[model samples]
Target: MFEWMAWTTPVVVFFTCIVLMLIAMTVWEIRSPTVMRKGLLPIATTRGDRLFIGLLTAAYINLLFVALGEKMMAWFGLEQEPSVWISFALSMLLLSIIMKKG
Candidate 1:
């Protein structure tokens, strides 16, 4: 009852915060759906354009999350986590290469 809530409350709050942040990000991206559309004009006329566009959008969003998370951790003086940095670098590299041939 009350004893269980004492420990679970923090976990629930953490997840709730994450969900809220994700929702905010979604709204922000939807508001500016055109920025990530760059370099896709040539492929826009193709039948697979929509699919490609969606993939690129997903990549861009993931990259942003990784990059932003790293910055946030550093800004808050949190412990430097290797996995987070690795994910950030990997995301950036993949995004760079994927967006090249477009």
Candidate 2:
């Protein structure tokens, strides 16, 4: 059913993480509801809100890495364009930070 999509390992991992996070958040919300609060972000936000923003930011970061990979390699004089794995790691880290402090 999914053969039309590439289904690469990174793609699978990224979507899996997102699905797991959504499930976890749903369970946590049922157990203890989140209250909106202000953090580093200008507006108050609930856990789900933070997660949504973080996910969007992570997606953009990955897109930027893909779009700029060649230019980045040229500037750094690397043997090859930066690996998508590097962007994945960085984007995940950024998501973590947003979830923690957004």
Candidate 3:
């Protein structure tokens, strides 16, 4: 099962972080309802909406990074593809920004 995936440590950690975020968000929503409001995002959105958007953004970021990893390594004359952790950190940072201001 799941053999098609490499199931790397970074991949596991990234998914674990997402799961934890969803749980935390669910609890936060129950504790305090959110109101639709405008932020850095063009449209007014609730916390849940922002989370969804953030999740999508993070996925795209990770995919893009992975797709370009080899090219990036070649461009930089590296011995191997860039670390997946770079994508994870970038995705998490963007997710935090989206959560706070999107």
Best-to-worst TM-score order = 2, 3, 1
- Per-residue lDDT of model 2, residues 1-102, tens digit only: 988986899789868987998899999999999999899998999999999898899889999999999999899999999999999899989989988989
How many residue pairs clash per model? 0, 0, 0
Candidates' C-alpha lDDT: 0.56, 0.92, 0.91
State every prediction's TM-score relative to the real structure. Answer: 0.28, 0.84, 0.77
Give candidate 3's TM-score.
0.77
Candidate achieving the largest lDDT: 2
Clashing pairs in model 2?
A: none
Better candidate by TM-score, 2 or 3? 2
Q: Taking the tens digit of each residue's C-alpha lDDT, what string does model 1 give over 1-102?
A: 558556676688867965885586568557755333445345432223433454566567666666677676878777863355555466556544444534
Give per-residue CA lDDT, model 3, range 1-102, as digits (tens).
898886899789869987998899889999998999999998999999998998899889999999999899889999999998899899989988998988
If the candidates were sorted by their lDDT against the true structure, best first, what order would they fall in?
2, 3, 1
Q: Looking at model 1, which ten-residue stretch has the lowest summed lDDT?
A: 43-52
